[model samples]
Target: MPAGKSQYRKGEYPTFEDYSIYAQRVVLNGEFVQHSHDFDEIVLILSGTGEHLVGQRVYSLKRGDVFVIKGETRHGFRGAENLELVNVMYDPRILLSGEGDLRAVAGFAYLFLVQPAIAQQEEYPYAVFLDEDATETASTLCGFLIRQLEDCAGQYQVAVQYGFKTLAAYLANHYRTREDLSEKLGIFTRAVQYLQYNAARPIKLQEVAEAAAVSQRHLERVFFEVCGLSPMAYLLELRLRHASLLLRGTSKTVAEIAGECGFEDPSYFARVFKRKYGAPPNQCRNAKAL
Candidate 1:
């Protein structure tokens, strides 16, 4: 692809308004152009070969190649023969915000989250390549998802959500079973999974590192490389996110919500919550109510 910059926005697409998800299949004979978007994308290579340009690195692409593009990460494809792929574009904040269980799946965090974070890093290895059977299965699921998205009829929204989640879970499980997963990536994935599973309880860096079978220093380095946050910081982020959702969606009191979210002190929770959200817990809740 030529060296240039372009951007795609979610609001520019019709399907984004209803469910914040869109699917499209494309065939590229030449270059697809270097561009970034405001939403995340899951790319599934259905057939043929190409060169995928991510940031400053270029990687070979082929059938069954699966990877994620985080929002605003400049990338493109070139040197294509018959590059065919399916792009599932979505707003993760909308599709995955409340799906804690799905995030806890064995390889979900690695494939969707850690991969994207480390894509441009030197340690970035390769995209997840599905075998022939898994590729066919994934393609079928994508076809059904695309059809539902195009139909856009009554109750189709729910069906589309279910279909996407099913595909995501399938891919994650496949990643979990892959024998080629890098050791560093595995450690990061395990650490993240442990953090997500135990976010509602008070957790220490030592606990997270032990869960990943790595030392605290190594764990911190991996977390910084993949998430740009320390382990404790990431846990706090998870806790605060949960607290925000509860404050908006439930009738729980501030102190109760604080404890449930793993904050031992209501006053500390309120102080930090205000620092993060720019309002006290009660005020934030009331604002959401109005």
Candidate 2:
């Protein structure tokens, strides 16, 4: 570990009881020591220039640069010249679990999942650079999100969640239109989106590769290198996550949820669910009920 690497806990930040979104604007004149946090962060550079060190890689930062830093990734900034940025830290497990519609957008998966996953492996992680107009718009959205967090008025949580989602969707949509996205990354993003769209059905590695116009072997290698999981394992995780959401939010039977989440056998689903969540579906649902 690097010297001065600090750990930032989510509990240390002010967040709503029901929502975990936190936003703050930071201005740095000198070095910010290396640190890792317990929540995902969306960084939007507002002004000036700096050097960002992520893991063992260093990248230059400037105005309009946007990227994500996943939880527990050690990163810091140095050689700062009035570097200004908005850091939107969030708990994806709480925010993304219920937003199935966002998953339908391929850019969402690419921006939040694929880009962060490949950052350590690739020379430069993919980032979306906003133009002057878009930068202004994003700054306004971040300001609104920060105000919502501060005010704590009635229905403020709702506004905060919606505000975060709006910022996320706007960035994802912008990324989708960028001409600089590499062909290989495009293939990977397509494969992830296909899996997201078809996770409720029985699918195979070959099918996923075909959807992405790549060979099964190649796809497996890419998934492992970028996502740290085999394609099949990733799909299983998606299915289980969906099943967990259904278990908590719906009155569906375990068998129904199992089937709906692409588990062909209820017994097998129960075993896998127990292994992953440390509880069977019914027990999980009952606990949620109470």
Quick one: best TM-score, which candidate?
2
Q: What overall lDDT goes with each candidate model?
A: 0.80, 0.78
Instruction: For each of the candidates, give the backbone clash count.
Output: 0, 0
Candidate 2 clashes: the total is 0
- How do the residues 1-290 of candidate 1 rate in per-residue lDDT, one tens digit apiece? 45435888788877887877889998877777889987789999998888988887787887888888887688898887788999999876543544435776777777876677667665566567788898899999999999998998545777888888888888887742234667766788898878877876789899899999999999999878767889899888878877876786578899999998899999999999888888888998742322
Model 2 residue 134 distance off true place after TM-score fit, in angstroms: 1.4
Best by lDDT: 1
In model 2, the worst 10-residue window by lDDT is 92-101
lDDT of 2 by residue, 1-290 (tens): 22344887677776734567788998876688879886789999999888877777777886778878887687888888889999999876554555436776647777877777656553654655788788889999999988888787446766777888888888777642235667767777889888877887889888999999999998988877666888899989988977877785579999999998999999999999999988778999743332
Evaluated at residue 207, the lDDT of candidate 2 is 91
RMSD of each: 4.8, 4.6
